[model samples]
Target: MKARLMWIAGSLIVIALLGYGGLSYALRQNPHAVLDTVDRIAGPSGSVEQVAEASTGPHRQQRLLVYRSDDAAEALPVLVFFHGGSWAHGDPQHYGFVARSFAEEGFVVVLGGYRLGDEGRYPAMLEDTAAVVGWVHANIAKYGGDPERIFLGGHSAGAYNVAQVALERHWLEEEGVPESALRGVIGLAGPYDFYPYDSASTKAAFGSAGAGAESQPVNHARAGAPPMLLVHGEADTLVKPRNSRALAKALNEAGGRADTLFLPEGDHNAPLLSLANPWRRDPLVHDRILAFMREAAKVSVPVQPQTP
Candidate 1:
């Protein structure tokens, strides 16, 4: 009987060790992990630079990577990007492939990080976004970009943040950035409305949307807002496609150029990934974005400005 007991205890110890190892692995797979993975996939071909941290606190540092095309010197339009991971999870590095691909397509790309989760909320995200925009405007020329042709965009939670920052106006205006500074807004699989504060994280970030949940992008649509290009996956279970639909309809009614492209049978993950792999034969999300930027920036043909 003692021998049997010893065997059982030894099995339990092994199980405990396995459990601990699994937990550690999960913990390591945070937002930063995604960034690291993208960097691995994209390699070191591009010039990477550390740009700024969240201006409000020491929680995060932003970075920008430039992948120079042959014609990078001319005043190329810029795409300021925000990566998404439910507001608490993603980093700019997670979307580095997208940034590098765009940079290679004759545009400058700015990727930035923002304070996540409880460390920052609501106006804080707005402030960080405004600060990044200000940084881009004031310093993009050093990296071969045009401040006048800045396109603000993000994916998923990042998309919602961008929409809020662009529509709210107070954040940017307070930062001394005029509303006209942005040429357009691009949102990918973002939750522009439907804030459910039932979850602890949502409550901490957006407050109790409760009765006032309607005050999201859908409700705040007004004229003079920059044009919006919304790309959503119809099968996205995490964030419904209706969120994009609602925002697009409102923007159109408000006399803004708002267009929604529904990906046929595409889920949230593939659309953004497809941008970097055109051979995926998926409708080119990147091409759509380029077309939108060209129209918005009024650059009928590729124009490379002189490098400083």
Candidate 2:
């Protein structure tokens, strides 16, 4: 019996290692292609429309994609989401599954594309995000969304970007939008407090941005910041759960409304992936986000209690 148990454990270890190796190779070869393949397999169930083309920086432009429900006559809250790829590579097309799910849930969803780390550094991606928000603020009404009921959300590095924009306020201000323009922020598996610039990706993306401390969202948390919903996976090996805990604690200490949801069985991508077809593990991620946004927008709707 002991020998059989050992064999089982050894086989599991080998399988795990092989899975990790395969994923690493796929990501290293072409991260976007990997995401595209997943998205194609998931098959987004809603419609997406390209709303506008905007400049990210000098000589560079990116398009904005908006997802809306079939019933377009009613004005609904808008959610603008940013994708995460360690600030290096990600496209709005890769997140259609997320956007479509939110759209199906009675909210208009916008996905913004930005220049990657190699294409631009530090504030470039932030600026592109702001531009997308600015466009949504100005033109979302045409797509059956309320301009005043805008929210921001992202995953991983994209969550860091959303937090920076929502917390710092200057990025949006530069785009002629007030901080009050946002109803709330949702961060999934975000590295809100990581600092010291130890990793190669961090160095490449934010090394020249002055102090590494300045790039963190925790440093910028203050009173009157938009309400936040930070969700992290307890099992996430990539970005520690402490990042979300610290950010939520800071926001609450600073007199802002912040809530956190920690998924016991989830890994780094679980929070966002729950929005895909047939939420399996962390089913409450979507409901929690929608509840938070609806409450912020002052729109009355019945929300079921979040699953533990």
Q: Which candidate number has the best lDDT?
A: 2
Query: Cα lDDT for residue 28, model 1?
Result: 54
**Per-residue alpha-carbon lDDT of candidate 1 for residues 118-225, written as tens digits (9 for 90 to 100):** 655775666777778887788777767888888888888778878988887786777777776688888999888775555565676777323356437777888778
Report model 2's TM-score to 2 decimal places: 0.82
lDDT of 2: 0.76
Top candidate (TM-score)? 2
Candidate 2 backbone collisions, by pair? none
Worst 10 residues of 2 by lDDT: 299-308
Clashing pairs in 1: 73-305, 74-304, 74-305, 75-304, 75-305
RMSD of each: 11.5, 7.8
Tens-digit per-residue lDDT, 38-114, candidate 2: 44343433344444444444534356788886655568889999988888877787777777667777788898877
lDDT of 1: 0.68
Per-candidate local distance difference test = 0.68, 0.76
Clashes of each: 5, 0
Model 1, backbone clash pairs (residues 3+ apart or across chains), number: 5
